[model samples]
Target: MTTQSIKVTIKRGPDGQGAFDVPAHDNQTVLDVVSWVQQNADPTLSYRFACRVGMCGSCAMMVNGVPRWTCRTHISKVIKDGAVTIAPLRNLPVIKDLVVDMDPFFDKWVEAEGVHHGSLTRHDPIAPVDETSATRVEANAGIECINCSVCYAACDTVAGNPDYLGPAALQRAWTLLNDAKDEGRGAILDAVSGSGGCHNCHSIGSCTTYCPNDLDPMSAIAGLKRETTKSFFRRGR
Candidate 1:
């Protein structure tokens, strides 16, 4: 019996770059291919993955020019001409083969004021949250983000503007803004309304298109825009 094979090309930075013909199997995922390469072909191949079930976005990579979670991306879905190309996520500094520096990606989150600032301390009585409220509904829309950076990698605005806060950061800001208990509304708005803020977004929807969790960071940015505009008008009055 003869085993079928697929061509796999990996972008291995300056020193190493090449393709390998690996045995293909049914229901094989891109992660599986990469793991095989590291285990059989090259032990030096470096990549990051925590949860292979798609919960952790650490396995995200550029597959065929699109950012996708390698663990969830099956070879059958993305294979073209019996071949696949894997590279580090774009708009980030490549650390090595299939790995990119995530510091800058996370730094933007802090710059966007994505962290929650509460008015109450831990000793204070916990306030009951109205889950059905309008603000809660909007907040819930983007709260599922795992900071996978998939949307960040797909965003063209981030590619062009290095200072621009990427989709995840801006979306997180919007999420915090809608939280009833959050007291950082003023700071978040001020942060996102700056030159490299939400306005820098091209509204291309690539963040939404590539988000593995199906969260819409594009819409969240639009929400920030609307809120910022309203904030601008209210201050004038």
Candidate 2:
């Protein structure tokens, strides 16, 4: 219900000190302001978004130095002094303007073996698993991840060491590790073990602090440390 014009400033490129000044409404989200500028003020301004309603992970950016979903971020809360600074999400290669290269962010998922791998035979009798089972409940917590990379972008671990697989991807691996159907749980754990893997997570939890979806990636990383340690005893049969 605010009726004032919002002062919005956007950092146009990687290491860009210059900013694009734009006029925005108090009620408008940061995403709305950026779109308006692209449509009316600067046609060449580059950014990325899809499903502006907040379901798609494409619209994440740095709103006043915090990685967040621009579509859902309100100007009022972000701009305490009536001024806003928009920039590309942190810990990634800035391609141009507000757009960033997402390849490295996604590559970590593969590194952690985030994909599900099960060897269930459809011809065999179906196993009746309780809907309220503990494993299922634990997996449910991580199932809502939208892969926005905000957690990865906010993580100091990822920022310091580029090879680190990151919290989001590691969290995905943790979900699979507890799955009864996942035959690759052992391999997934193997992939995520060691220094550059789960052990390197300092548990500073910047990922959980900045995750827009309210996920606790820090706990997931802890799970990896526990499970991988247990597996060490069983190694080599």
**Per model, how many backbone clashes are there?**
0, 0
Clash pairs (backbone) in predicted model 1: none
Off by over 4 Å in 1: 1-3
Worst 10 residues of 1 by lDDT: 1-10
Give one digit per residue, the lDDT tens place, for model 2 in 124-189. 787665658888777778888999999988998888998899999999998887676677987898
Q: Compared to the true structure, candidate 2 yields what TM-score?
A: 0.92
Maximum-TM-score candidate: 1
Q: List RMSD in Å for every model shown.
A: 1.6, 2.1
Model 1: per-residue lDDT, tens digit, 110-222? 99998989879889999889999999999999999998999999999989999999999999999999999899999999999999999998899999999999999999999
How much lDDT does each candidate structure score? 0.93, 0.84
